[model samples]
Target chain A: MTEAIQNVANPQIEVKDLNLWYGDKQALKNVSIQIPKNSVTAFIGPSGCGKSTFIRCLNRMNDLIKSCRIEGEVSIEGKDIYGPGVDVVDLRKQVGMVFQKPNPFPMSIYDNIAYGPRIHGVNKKDLEGVVEHALRSAALWDEISDRIRSPAFSLSGGQQQRLCIARTMAVKPEIILFDEPCSALDPISTAKIEELIMNLKKDYTIVIVTHNMQQAARISDHTAFFLMGELIEFGKTRQIFENPGEKSTEDYITGRFG
Target chain B: MGLNAKTSERIAFAFLTLAALTVAGFVLFILYYIVSNGYNAISIEFLTEMPRKMMTEGGIYPAIVGTIYLIIGSMLVALPMGILAAIYLTEYAGQNRTTWAIEMAINNLAGTPSVVFGLFGLAMFVKYLGFGPSLLSASLTLGLLIIPVIIRSSEEALLAVPPEYREASLALGISKWQTIRHVVLPASIPGIVTGSILSIGRVAGETAPILLTGAAYFLPRLPDSVYSQFMALPYHLFVLATAGTNIAQTRPLQYGTALVLLMIVLAVNFVAVLVRRYYRQKLKI
Candidate 1:
């Protein structure tokens, strides 16, 4: 754990004693972790283990849900995001998110990518370039450049998911949160998104929630294991997968118990 | 011990065909009766000219213009208020006791009798506001009458928009108002237009509200302003059919007016269907 923390000089996101509840039911229990700057950190847990809930808190997506209550500090770039006077809109701009399912707006593909930048009031002079850049970053520009005006729903399922990624990238967020982004994709599309994530690490800090242990081991530099609302272990991806410090982490990675 | 499968299948087919033909036959019989009686009087003179002094020679021009005025006026008043109320109910208001109560109130308002609305409109707009028995007063009355329909339909349209769209916009750091303006409203425009058109159809055909608040006699000229008195098709037909002294003489004019009104209503409905189809095609891509 110390070696993993030492490898990265500057951390991008530091969550301290974060707890979340949905009315009377608690979802996350005192989760604390440091995510390194410009590195991929994967959260691995079974379904309903609060991994998705924790990611939603990073971008304030949980705010829209009724009966959701979040506690403790979640900070990005040394600023506490949940502190008083924090504008959730500004926080979301800095921290973008992709959902598990592909949810393109019922509009054209160009509009879907351009939507974020347009809302944030990006100048018209720069919008065309920005949209192109985002789509390119998501590795979807080549297939879609000729027919950008086509409706987004015309795209294949994998393509739609990539378009969602492009939409997130258009806003130029510092940190991107992914909630089981590849869970709905096949092996081919999943591999493509994984490759895109690896490339994206050079520019954006990524926090991913994935049920696939192999995916977490393959793409993430740092990994955190969660089970039943508790953070069981956190370490370098290599260490966590190869030789975990805790028995529970080993058991989960080895398919002993989810 | 075995059933005759082929015979049973033939019997079922025969029963289904008979039931379908029965409904079709009833509808066609009513349509044939209305059209044969209404179609003979439809002509250029019967459409463009006003009712003659002798009560036999002219058309339903005044009533046609009055129906248009009443429908347009009602739409102008009801559409904005209905959309705003729907937005407040669905987007801003929490799903609590107050919202539930409001929803219940609107549903009951929709179920209220048209005559009750006419009485209410007479008391409120005519007696209290002193607008008089004019086009404006009638329009206001009809507007109140159709607001419940608009509210219910617009709310349903807005609700039809998936929750994922809102979540996506919020996750992109867009403000709630901005999200609704750019995404939700644009997607729901087809539904809104359909609802508005349906409400307008109701306004055109409504007779009770107009009877309570509008001019009972035919006006030679079109209404010059919102407050001016005007003759509507429904009121004109009612008078021509029932109260006119020369019933045998004015019967053609009455049938002509009814036909024109039916055509206008049908045209409006056709346009709504076309608009919906256009939007559906656009949304499919």
Candidate 2:
């Protein structure tokens, strides 16, 4: 396993020997990686290779599954996220997530963006400004700014994904995780999300788990390839895609196998 | 293959349609019989007057008020408790042995007979608690009888809200309780309200619990306190049909009382339907 992390000073997220299980069925093996600040890192692998599970470990989403258990150290910004006296709510606020499917609340578009802020105790007077800023940041402001009060379901799938991104940004989180966010979207929507993600790197660190290898090649600055719960190789996206680092990484990315 | 499949499909459709119409026909026939026999006896005087001439010729004013009170009291006891218990079970309870046991217990409570509830109410609320066969005792009994229904329906509603919503909310750093109050509970309103309305109908019509707990054969006037004895429509109809001085003479009056009871239940249901629709539109789900 080539886990040599290159060209990084002060990594935003660092993991060490992370192992996870679902009722004794090991889902993630000893995996470690260091993700730099202000960069897009993509995790690509075959189905059930634990790429999605690895992404969820960042925000501790696996806590919701009753049978899921973990034994490893995951740190964000030099703080152990899986440490004692930590609140999942507070950690999630700092590290937000966008799911595979766009899940807008059963409320208005404006309300969807404002949900995070309101729950975080943002003043009623400042909510409009916060919602607009988040929407503008997500690049969805120009399209549906006129109908902010309409139900979120009215938006197209791609637009809903942008709305979700906007929803994540509303709380001003420093890190955002996209878990196959474009899987449910069409290519056009996927392209738009890709563009939005590249532009977002200037302000926030992004970790995306995508099945599409071409998508990883197109958007990510750092690429990590996994095969069945173990990290195969981790390095610059260009080197991983173009040059041969590991035989499986070469096989997995060249359309030989997923 | 096509013709045989089509024939079977048509037969199934017809069978389902016939079953539905048969049920509807039974209901319509009951409504028609009640109206035809009771309409002649209904008058302003009959609705307002107290019984006269050995309970043979008068109105059921107190019974009407008593049923309404019972309905309100039972809701007061059941709605908040049922909804909160349901929220606790679905949102807070871990998937473990305790939750499994509670789930089994709730299912059993739902299948228990209403008369058993009446008997339990008699012993617990009436004798042990010293509430003494009053409206309080009956209201508590009916509330307990229908609480399982509310909890089950509420659990369904809560579960119907996709796990994604809860995840989305939690992902935004919202606490569990806040996620439930803001997202989960609001989305499940229609299901919760519909379930509660069905329970309300059962409470309004049930006679057994009230019979052992609160209902009287005839009240001089409306019972002023929850502790006082009351006259309920189902129990009133029961007395008129079996224990009245002239059961044959008051046959029309029995139907009238039945008609009145049906109308009250329907009227309550109508209001609940409007509320459910209003929430549906407002939430736009």
Candidate 3:
């Protein structure tokens, strides 16, 4: 056991004693978890259980909230992200995010996909290929190929979400954080996004916060069930669902409680 | 009870309709009065030729040109500062007492009278900066007067851009400045442009701001430069109606000048509407 602790290989992201507060109200309390590389880890909880808040900590998205104060260490690739010397821009570059609602920028389809790369100093010569590659990876290239110059808002909700995914993919982040990405989509769109996530984990570390128990069971390799700002259990999705070691995790999975 | 509800609803509808029509009626009345009195005075030569004699006989071409210059000049000063301030307030500033104080100051500044701004300009730009009674002084004054309007309008526009968009961009590992430039500004440009057009219209028609700062009673030629005092439509109209040697004789000229100023403002508003429509279409919002 001592040898195991001494020589454990670092996970892609390791969060230790992560705590967050919005003004006086604590939102996350002592959350410690290790997310393996090239795997989908689903954060499952009911509303206000800190699942989303915990996921947001991975990329420092909570910094946008005026009252949010974070404590403890969040390391990506074994480097402390909250350390003084860490460049937040570079940290964010390695940790992309997708939002709950589809928020395609008010621009053409091509411009939407090209926005991230262009800002990161990708020249115009390479942008065309980058945009195309991102779109294809997000499974939207075939549908939006002809309407590349058309406004992004012209697409359906499903297509718009896909475009948003493509936009995030353009930055080529190693880890992609999804904050209820399919919460606003139709079931068909939700299914498509699920499939996309499953396929994406082959190349990128994916963290998803979801309310859907079945979704976490279906797609995620690893599952972490949260209850009232505490992680109840963390293990293989199958183990957590079929034979959870914790009663709370079993209750949440069986829909008896959240 | 049903009959009472219906009666009250009908009365409310009537009041709302009357209120809306009253506004439209006043606008129509003003347009009719100006156009009727001014139409005979307007001609191709009147629009093209420079004024002759004691500001009574010829065109307001110089005033028209000067007004355009002032509008463009003021916009150049106000637009960038206002937009940047708004972005900082909405995107970066924490919800603290300092941010609240700055917001309150902007609101108060917007409420400050144009004439007060004119006096401030006289004391500051004209006297202290040594610009004298010139276009530079007047434009800078007008720009100061409208900065609050730009800031308020752009702030509202920036706020109206859904937080979802900002979050989505930030999640992509894009920097804050990049997100604002690419997402927030593009989404909010139409609103900013509308505010700018409103400011331009107000600046074009304002007599009080230019009275002390820069407008000339009559300048023979176009302003040689920003340093030169220039004729402006509002001040020219003021001169024609009240200060000219033959105020009665130049009554038609007053109406004509008023009509021209109104036309210029309307043209600006029309362009604003077109630009807004074009972006709305392009963005498919």
Candidate with best lDDT: 2
lDDT winner between 1 and 2, please give it.
Answer: 2
Across residues B201-240, which tens digit of lDDT does each residue of candidate 3 receive? 8889888988999999888799999999998999998788
DockQ (C-alpha) of model 3? 0.78
Alpha-carbon RMSD, each predicted model? 2.9, 2.3, 2.5
lDDT of 2 by residue, A22-117 (tens): 998998999888999999999999999999999999999999998999999999999999999999999999999999999999999999999989
Q: What TM-score would you report for chain A in candidate 3?
A: 0.96
Each model's lDDT = 0.87, 0.93, 0.88
Interface RMSD of every candidate? 1.4, 0.8, 1.2
- Order of the predicted models by DockQ, top scorer first: 3, 2, 1
Q: Between 2 and 3, whose DockQ is larger?
A: 3
Better by lDDT, candidate 3 or 1: 3
Q: Model 3 misses residue A89 by how many Å?
A: 1.3
| Per-prediction tally of clashes | 0, 0, 0
> Which ranges of candidate 3 are over 4 A from the true structure?
A1-10, B1-3, B96-101
Q: Which stretches of candidate 2 lie over 4 Å from their true place?
A: A1-3, B1-17
Considering summed lDDT, which 10 consecutive residues are worst modelled in model 3 chain B?
B1-10
Q: Give the better candidate number (1 or 3) by DockQ.
A: 3
